[model samples]
Target: MPHQSTAPPTRFHRSIFARTVLWAIIIAAAITACLWLLTDATIRNTNQIALERAVDLDLAGMVDIHASGGREELARRIADRIALQPRDGQLAHYLLADTAGRRLAGDLRQWPGLHAGVSESGPIALPGGSAFARATQLGPDLRLLVAHEDHDIDALRRQVALVYVTGGLLATLAVALIGMTAAHRLRTRIERINAAFRHPDEEALARLEKGSLDRDEIDELTRHSSEALARLGRLAGAQRETTDQLAHEMRTPLMHLDNRLVKALAAAPEAETAARIADARLEIRHIVRMLESLLDIAASQARRGDRHGLAPVDLSALALRLGELYADSAEESGHTLKLAIAPDVMVEGEEMQLTRLITNLLDNAFKFVPVGGTVELRLAPGPSLTVCDDGPGVPLADREKIFDKFARGSEPGTQDGAGLGLALCRAIAERHQLEITLLPSTRGACFKVAPQARR
Candidate 1:
């Protein structure tokens, strides 16, 4: 035979940290892109404004000098003055031209073919090669032109470059810090998981669960794991109890069958046959009841969420109807059954589930009450239902246990049930977000189911 798989079963398992980090990196990239767009727009606008102002200032001085008719002398002086200024030649290299398109005192071999005012003129080949020119008309026939170097706006380029570099560096730094913090917390959580996985033993789990490490995605996983362990512990205890109960329940019938067989063997033949048949019928009924109880438990668990849809239910009317249905049975059993339903009581729930919940409580009351005992069903405007019986009430210690699957307050030898009625009742009530509790009673079991107001 092929080897069977030994891997543990799991529901959707994956790393939460990986998902969180991936999302963080994506968000950081988006922020960086947005910063680049805004910075680029601002820088370009500032550079254009500054370049226009520089041209205007230089043009004003040139126009004043040319209008005075100080042609050759003024051009020479202007060039000399430009050379002496701090950022004069540094801002732009000049190429001055006279009115008849003649080269003047600046660097150009000829006029740049424009009587200009802050306009683009480019690809003007000189001894060096092609270049870009920013020219402005200075006089009737004289033009003053400024051309940037062939290296292509290096200074302004550097400023934009620096902005991006700084922005990228900052983005990288932030991402690194976030990634480091995430990884550190992730490592701690993985360590805890490893420790818990290796020892699954309580002490290790307790240390991991109780110790407040750091708050991150890992903390969520650790908390979930802790909760899962607690649930598993409860499930294990319940399983043990169920196993013990099943064994005990099966043994009783088997023992009775054995005694019946022995008794039949020693009796007269005619009576012996009848005695054996009766014993057989009893054993069959016991087995059938056990099977029916098991089916009910399975059905209840399967139908847990089938009643989730909202429906308006009149609680008081339903209680009154159930009270009437059980009245005759209660009288025949020599127990007094009474109903006290408040007017206009309503709730939002599945009518069938609510009905079943009430029926189970009344069933338990009827089972426990002795002859001439009283069972009362009460409903009030408080939107609560209470059932009380005049029988031995449940002990304080067994209150919670009585609602557990296959649990009963009394010993199995005395009770005639599979011990699932109260558990089913609790499940049905809880599904509707109703609170059911064992209330204090004078001499009998009293229980209440209180539902919250619906919005």
Candidate 2:
């Protein structure tokens, strides 16, 4: 089996880009909220100050008329003038009160509960309706109250509301524009970084030959990617050269060794020579198997494609064949092997590879099972194949690791061949996008292979 390379697991971590964007949004929200509050407070303050000024000017005019001994005459004239302004659906309530809060000549029924020296203010609601009011001391014993209904104040309120809404919308739009620009720039930079991580292969070679760098983040990324790829390219090139050299140098020698062993065994004159020939043959098979597994891994990796000659292969027949093949050996070892194939079970995949996968699984089951134990081969329409054996079940800790190349639970130097069987099976199953699982069973290992189409 070929050596497998796997990476260690790491804790989940947030990216720098995510953190930057999150902080940007938080700051934008805070600034917008502060601006809204300030704008709202200023509008209210300005309206109250203007209203106070208007009320004071009106009060001064009334005082001038009273001083000229035109109190009754001016009151009639001012009342007529005030009545001339439209009062329909308008809150206009006037109150003339003494220092002791006694009503005089106005439509208001009573004085409002306001603290002295409190003047500048906007609208407030009373039992009668809504009004904006201002009040002042007219003399030592008289007070003047002037107020207008909230119709004009309502219009002003609407205007202020509209301003705040428009301001908020504009702020949001500006934030969106700024965020998009920053994100675009950041994305461009990161793309270049990512291009650096990819392997240098044929496509990368073509890109290098293009000899063009736009000189942005993407370019930096491409340059870094090229450097990493170059390193991997050199390593892969060296490895390929070594493999080719080994195959060229060893194939003939191995064949010669096998030929010599066979010939010497045929004319052996002693038990010692026969035993030596047997050992040589066994060693030669082991070397050949190792080389073959390597060649398979390399060829699969290089092709970058799956075999395309797919057809519906009857899984039931395959299971029956395996059951019959292993039944004799299983019986010889005082164990029982059985086939429980459902009729017309079919799957779509490479027939040869699937057969080998099943064969390897059965071989493992047989090797692991104790005498008088039972091994069952099940083939069904829905899922395809399940190989179970009443042997020592694989421990939970070893289940995942056993699928790795050259990994086995058996003691070293005892198993007959390299532990490539399960790894090869897994590779073939994955190429077809099928799921293979080791199901918990009663006292043994149970493996199930389910094809995508069947599932």
- What is model 2's C-alpha RMSD? 7.4
Per-candidate TM equals 0.45, 0.66
Candidate 2 has its poorest 10 consecutive residues by lDDT at 1-10
- The top-ranked prediction according to lDDT is 1
Give a tens-digit lDDT track for model 2, residues 1-455: 11111112222244555456556766776777777678667867777676666666765666676678554654564566568766666445566667788876566767776542455445556666766777766567776677765346657666866776677667766776787677667754554344333323465445653433766655665565666667776876787788788886887799888998898888954998788779889999888877766665453343222333446677678778877888888888898988888976666556786777788888888888777888899887775578898777887667878877787775443356687778777776775556578887667899998854533
lDDT of 1 by residue, 406-428 (tens): 78676433366667788778777
Where in model 1 is the C-alpha error above 4 Å?
A: 1-16, 78-100, 116-156, 159-170, 183-209, 212-243, 246-250, 266-455
Query: How much does candidate 2 score in TM-score?
Result: 0.66
Highest-TM-score candidate: 2
lDDT, residue 76, model 2: 67
lDDT, residue 70, candidate 1? 72
